[model samples]
Target: MPAGVLFMFIIVFTTLVAVRMNSYVISALIIYVFFSIIGAVDDIAKVINQRKIAKGLISKQDYQYKADGISAGLRLFLYMTISLLVAMAAYKYIPNINGDINLPFISIVKRFPSLPFWLFIPFMTFTIAIFANGVNFTDGFDTLATVPSICCFVFVGIISFISSNSIWSNYLLIPHIVGLQEILPLIGAVIGTLLAYLWFNSPPSTIIMGDSGSVGLGGLIGILFIFTKAGFYLPLVGFIFFMEFASVAIQIGYFKLTGKRVFLMAPIHHHFQIMMRKSGLYKGEFQIKSKIAWRFHILSVVCLVLGLALFLKIR
Candidate 1:
């Protein structure tokens, strides 16, 4: 079985055992499970395609037999559908959370309030989809997604605990979210599973989490942000994933509009790897050493998380 399947089981079982289910947590978990299902379907399709190709059951030139797991349109449709369902459920079930958008580092008194439900639904859906794909794109290297994700979950789990407690929420000048504390176990479960998976997924990986894991994890992170009213912090907390997605977006947009490529490769990590090789910093044909890549990425994530935490504490 794919490691992702095992990871999902771990998440579900741990959440069930560790946290009492409430409407809010249940809705969030449902969204996470749905995203995982989409990923599993895609993984299955990819594996099947690979098997067919390897067996010479299908020719590469056959348009219908293209090895790409799922068409972008189909995947987008599924993502949007899932996002809409989750958004609707959140709107109906999650209390003390509405269309208010809080700006991070700003005074708690100020917020973008009373955003119409129609507008908020689409916006929330877009947020989930963007984060999900951002994570999917960032899973290019071993531990690239896993370790940073663990950091994100840890930080978010802390924030969730703080947000849920009225005393801490007032002291921190953040929104007080009732029942948000229930989601902490889900966060803990994710952290535990990722740590276990890291044993085989670190440098020179024996297994890859692939889309099934990355997308699901990303969606869960997005939901956690929404529930805790910490959506703005996502850019800071998930800085690496944000940069990876942004690099790809900018590279594609720039190349198409200016007839020039921004980087040797899309996704900044791969670009750095290419640069390291071309600069003669590494001896191997692969310029980016796995150890270097892992260390650099991990350090970047840790610094960002700690910096954000300190800023939040002192501000």
Candidate 2:
């Protein structure tokens, strides 16, 4: 079973209880589960295909396509459509949530600059979709995606908690988003769940979170930043995921533009793993994987600190 489905349910229960059934928390959980279900469907497809392969029902050539769960075109279509609907619903139904966003260094006297619905919907949708896939890419390594994600939620939780307080928001000069505090419990639930996941996902992993977990959690984080009015800071906080997604994009775009490739393998982590393999520096597969995972974890920690500093201290 994809632990994501169970975790999502747990998150929903814990957050609702923590917030005493806050409407915004309910709305957020619904969106989180929506994306998770999409990923779960893909995960189910892959699982069934694996069973078929084991039974010698799928040929090697056909296995590649079958193992990938849903077709890329179909997956992208769903991401775009669902993201658009979520963005529109967020804008129209969610209280105090709007297209307004926070800038890193800019200070607004009375109001933050806002985007019209026409622009905001597309922008938010893209953010959610890109991040949903970005995290899926990052999950290629054991505990690679889990630790950094925990770090990200830690930063987001702190920021959201502070932003919900008028005194702290004014003191730090961050936007005071009403009802944003309700998300703190949700973040807490997510962080707690990820921590537990990390215990199983550590180097020499027992199981993986898979697409079901990654996509749902990724989509949730994307929207969390938006609700906190810190969408601009996402790249700063989740730079590891951004790089993973970018590496693939760069590899594909560059390969088509020229005959050369950027990384040995796309997603960057795999590239690093390949580089380690070629150098013959790492003694074993376990060491190489652990080394790369640790480096990414450390980098994520650094990013979390810098992102928070810039968000809270540097004007």
Candidate 3:
């Protein structure tokens, strides 16, 4: 599981930080482990169940629970194991973080109390659940999931532009964080991985990012952004996610209050899919101009661009 690999990274990193006497990384490591195990168990159980179902002891409906989930679990398990071994090697690549690497940004971090770092754990956890659940709930058509995610990641990756450069951090008056450059590679890895995922997730998607990748990616963005001092604008950067989730939240709240449906269903994407399927919009002269998946990708990119502009402008 990618969660496991990420946990491995956090653990090794925290141990080194602990060995070096910085406790924040240790705190983060604890949170990372907790999150990773939760996801890993879910993944492991799904994979085991899928195998049983494939053996014909269980019904095919079991396999249909999350078609891509089992494969994702297997990928996550292998990747985590490999990452632990590789993370061990990175220690040799980067012996230790020094004053030079930690400079310019270190002072800015000192401005904040240590409590925020600890509190950041809950923030990250909730954000992941919301982000992942929103993505999963929104997955009704092609490009809807992956493309929006790509925009979100790219918007998040731009944080490095502010965090990586001391001059920019100073000019922007944002908290400077040394060693945040480490997140750049993480973002690159995600983008590259998504590119591979997109090959199958485009048009008629053969695979979905499922909850694993969605939650994983969302958590990665939130944590890296805050660690890099760009946490302030995450909501705006992920505006579409918030809007999509809000629709469902509003629907549920309304139904509880009035016992009436809102938007015809939860997560407006599915409502659009229903309309398209019923109207034969896929094959008719009145075929929808902006299909559900296409609109998701476009709107996500548009908002990401706007968010980036806001970031560059305000910062």
Candidate order (lDDT):
2, 1, 3
What TM-score against the true fold does each predicted structure earn? 0.90, 0.94, 0.64
Global Cα lDDT for candidate 1: 0.77
Output the lDDT of residue 207, model 1. Answer: 89
Q: List, residue by residue over 184-247, the lDDT tens digit for candidate 3.
A: 5445555666677678766545665444445444444544444544455666666666667788
Model 1 residue 292 CA deviation (Å) reads 5.5
TM-score of 1: 0.90
Per-model CA lDDT versus the true structure: 0.77, 0.84, 0.54
Candidate 1 Cα outliers beyond 4 Å, as residue runs: 58-67, 110-114, 285-292, 299-307, 310-315
* Predicted structure with the largest lDDT when compared to the true one: 2
**Cα error of candidate 2 at position 150, Å:** 0.8
Q: Evaluate residue 133 in candidate 2 and report its C-alpha lDDT on the 0 to 100 scale.
A: 83
lDDT of 1 by residue, 1-315 (tens): 357777788899989998988876887788788888888887888788777878997776653555437776788788888988888978876776587666645666654444679887887887788788788888877777887788778777887788789988788777787888898889988998888888987666788897788888888888777776667677777887788878888998999899999989988878877787778767784336575456756775775666456535663
- Superposed Cα deviation of residue 275, candidate 2 (Å): 0.9
Residue 2 local lDDT, model 2:
63
